[model samples]
Target chain A: MDVKEDLYHALLMEYASGCLDEGQSLIIAAHMALSPAARKTVAQYESVGGAILDDCCGKVAMTKDALARVLDKIDCGDSPSPCVQKSKSTMAYMNAPNCLQTYVESATWTDGKGGYQTISVRTSCHRSKARIYKIDPDTVFRVNTRSPHQLTLVLEGSFHDGRAVYRRGDLIVTNGDAVLHSDAEQGCICAVAQPSVFSVKRFVQQIFIRY
Target chain B: MYITATAVKSLAPRAPHSVNKPMESGRAQPKTANTNVNGAHHKSLLLRVASKKDREAFAELFEYFAPRIKSFLMKGGSAPDLADELAQETMIAVWQKAESFNPAKANASTWIFTIARNKRIDHLRRVRPEIDPADPLLVEDDAISAPERMGQQQETEAMAEAIKGLPAEQADLLYKSFFEDKTHADIAKETKLPLGTVKSRIRIALEKLRADQKVKELWT
Candidate 1:
């Protein structure tokens, strides 16, 4: 049994805190799926969230018709659709989580430059977006959504994030005003979720993995 | 108005003695016991919704949680209108998924607040685009049946007391992390502390929290 307790626990803490990078988040989330100890620890942090949420003690009134509207939505079957069941079952996304699938299936692929391609995932809630990307091995996938927060989750293959290697199921969340350039060690398929509108920039293919 | 006389009687021990009167339906007043959530009144209301498809019970739950949820979302910077939309969606989910509620696992507040948190996150990510990856408000199901959540039901008072006992520095860091939703990097930048120091401070606070004798027993 290979257990990276401290490493994964820290990751879980970041995840539970919602500060984890997309790549590392996917990794930790995947790791938690298989690691009970990590799951238990993350649960502790989540409970901490529960504690604070309880203490917030303020109330903002909802409109009188709010409940009626929700009931109306339910009556009309207008709630969020999970996805087309059959397409999801046959579609192979490897170890990707179900939440990832809902947005991934939203759009068709655009074009790729230098083995990197992207498709923006449409969401009904007008505030955010989900994008799916395909990156070939030995490439630096640079993104500049300029949005305050962006999450990258590796659906397949691996990448080197200038800190640690992010393999399949890894998530990396980056914030700030700087553009990011991360190198992939192998063919990587990822989904990027954000609220800002962005299209895939040009990809630079290079071999940098020290094997 | 949805709480029946029977429910008010049944939940007397769990709620403040004041709300037991039919005239004091709790519609205008939110319960003061923030810590002792999952009150029996709420559990009974949800149970009614689940078993009887009781709209009145659902209405009562909506009145209590919807506004609180809207405020919760706004604290994260959601617009009032958007927050209202998300809160509405959250209530609908509660109505649709009320059957899944298990009072033995979690209180009504923990469960309903979680739904609000998720809706807020989903809503923010759509509109704002650049949310912190480690946004501290990302909630998990807080039910007792959720493995580690089991013995925790009986420990909120103990946990609340223990939190007051934590070092001020540690508590401040926790406030920033949990209440303000600051990431370690963000906290470090704001406090001028090294990144490692910020993480360690948070880690220490968490360790102290989890190490509480009563809390430990609950988790175990």
Candidate 2:
């Protein structure tokens, strides 16, 4: 009950509708890892999505030899994805969902000229960009961008986005540069998803971003 | 925290639904295949595929889910051929992850469709790196929880009915938001409604489903 109740609820609904960008979705993933209530609520939304999916009309069967092709593709029946393995190993501290963790591992993070580094993960299906960022303790960072909609989730430590304190499992969604200033209480990592048409810049005024 | 009375009231001046009313479905929705109300048979079929490496069982699953997946992807705006290809990949994922499916947590229909959703996203990332519009609707293997007998299933039925009961414009918004993969901002641009109104309408629709007394009753 003490959770970031309304915000996560809205985010969960966005997630249920499949409208969240990857950055926002990843935040939900980590937040769910921290909150069982969020997990249960999210599960319910998934069920809602499932219920609707069951009602889609115009069912079509697969192409010829589809079964044969799949059987051939399977590594003798069961194929364990590497992402699942990583999820298990990293569950303790990372607390990131397997899907996001898989992407984060492969993504190339760029060290900004401040106490922060970032990796733009995936460009969205609708021309947005999903980025992950790392910030150091006691550091203040600024993102000057024209993203109409953006989402931020803290994977480590804590920070305040001028308006509220966001911790390891909180998702902060904003409209138009809502998080112009972020002061980290400790080392922090965040994933941000936004429209790709606009460029983003982060600055710490004067601080070295340790690799 | 529960929906605040103020937020719920501001959402829609008129609370459109009286939750506990027995469902009066005007739409004669198609029953799922072979009268399998819960898709329990599909789960058993999946179990066989997992434990026995049953090819026949997988083939049956392929027939049932592949096309539906195709429909799902296509509805979300994938090209027909691409949708077909992703559908194939989704079924393959199901084949590979059959052992991971837990009927106690989800029915097969829910499980397969969830996988289908993820596969579609994976395909999008692989083919087009520049496209980054995130689709948040994801169901993962680790997410376990059956729909409350009084909650999800009843909510689904009520939602379908609710969609029917919605004002035509609001109903259209729901379809685009849920089925077409359209964002609220995008919907506002298309419908010429303000973004705030679009967000409010979609959020209100969801609140309607979540506010169902049957859901609260079940939980309580």
Candidate 3:
């Protein structure tokens, strides 16, 4: 497989295995929403999980009253409520995929260097940080990666990373050495996740460059 | 959760492929003792629960799967008691959500596996965001023909068969990924294999599964 396909394959495997953190999981979930092929592959991988579970029959036994407890819970009407659907009005202005709607709705954007706005997305896993970035039309946004791996997913419009133009739902995975200079046309909104490595020099440069 | 060498070795002998012969001819072979029998039986039981709210069917499912689900949780390092609780919760979710189960989309084992996985995530104090299948922006598989859609019902069985036929090492890696909740990086660290090799092995395994499905489709 080519590099892009390879990365996507790896991501799908991790996602199917349920090993990805919340931020990374969101990205893959959104991508699957936009790509039927990815969805099919993920389903395949999950079937493998089911197969493994089936193979594991009788390894560890449950308590004898397990079924009785579950039936009691069901009879008592105490099961948790189903997931609440987002109201249409709340989803009205959201341009991101449904998987990301809640996060995007609650995020507050702050102005950043080079004519872009960003919001740090709250994530449970401390190993990585997630953020959403919005760039204006005809603007350039530069990000110097300090983490070993960074994943970017385009949510709206398009941006050229000097190699190819990435549109909505496209994912880009890069390593630390790559300096990304994204030029947006018609503006852009993207979600990014990387390890928790912040370069103080890069932050200082961005702050001073804005002045 | 840590998987000991002894645990993996004990599990390897009972891997499904060793028991089920690979499909050779589409029409000639009789159904043997394999997941297909159990899978189809469970699918019907779930459907009965969905259609009739049959407590008997639900009880049967609980008898079969609850133990497996508990074992699964324990393998992932949950305390035995916690695993038992989660397993009960997962079965309850299965009963409450039975109406939503679509055999065309996934079999009972696969469906319950997802529910169990979600419970495990909740137990870890983590979230697993997923696409809303009903999302307006979601891509539709409208191009798939009716026959292909019908073929999807068998896709899971094909996958199980495919996995059974995999090399032991690849199957072990997959078990680690799904059962132990190990990422490729973690598998590499544990197995002392390069990260790339782990990824590639998994990729190859998935490709083989897909290829097997395609071959089965041609026969259908």
Query: Residue B157 lDDT in model 3?
Result: 62
- The digit string of per-residue lDDT tens for model 3 on B108-175 reads 88889999988898778777789987789997854656776565545556665666677666666777
lDDT score, candidate 1, position B92:
84
DockQ of each: 0.17, 0.28, 0.48
TM-score of chain A of 1: 0.54
Question: Over all chains combined, what TM-score does candidate 2 have?
Answer: 0.65
Candidate 2 lDDT tens digits, A27-64: 56655655556666766666555555554333555577
Worst ten in a row by lDDT for model 2 chain B? B126-135
Query: Where does candidate 3 stray beyond 4 Å?
Result: A56-58, A80-93, A105-108, A138-143, A179-184, A197-211, B1-34, B213-220
Residue-level lDDT tens digits of model 3 in A26-88: 778888888787787787677777766765323457788778877888889977545555443
Scanning candidate 1 chain A in windows of ten residues, the lowest lDDT window is: A202-211
Calculate model 2's interface RMSD in Å: 7.8
Model 2 Cα lDDT, one tens digit per residue, B94-171 = 877889886665557667767876776666553211111132322233443445532433443444444445454454
Give per-candidate clash totals: 30, 11, 0
lDDT to native, each model: 0.56, 0.57, 0.70
- By lDDT, the best candidate is 3
Order of quality (TM-score): 3, 2, 1
Q: Candidate 1: interface RMSD in Å? A: 8.5
Model 2: per-residue Cα lDDT at residue A163: 64
- Winner of 1 and 3 under DockQ: 3
Q: Share of real interface contacts recovered by each model?
A: 0.22, 0.28, 0.65
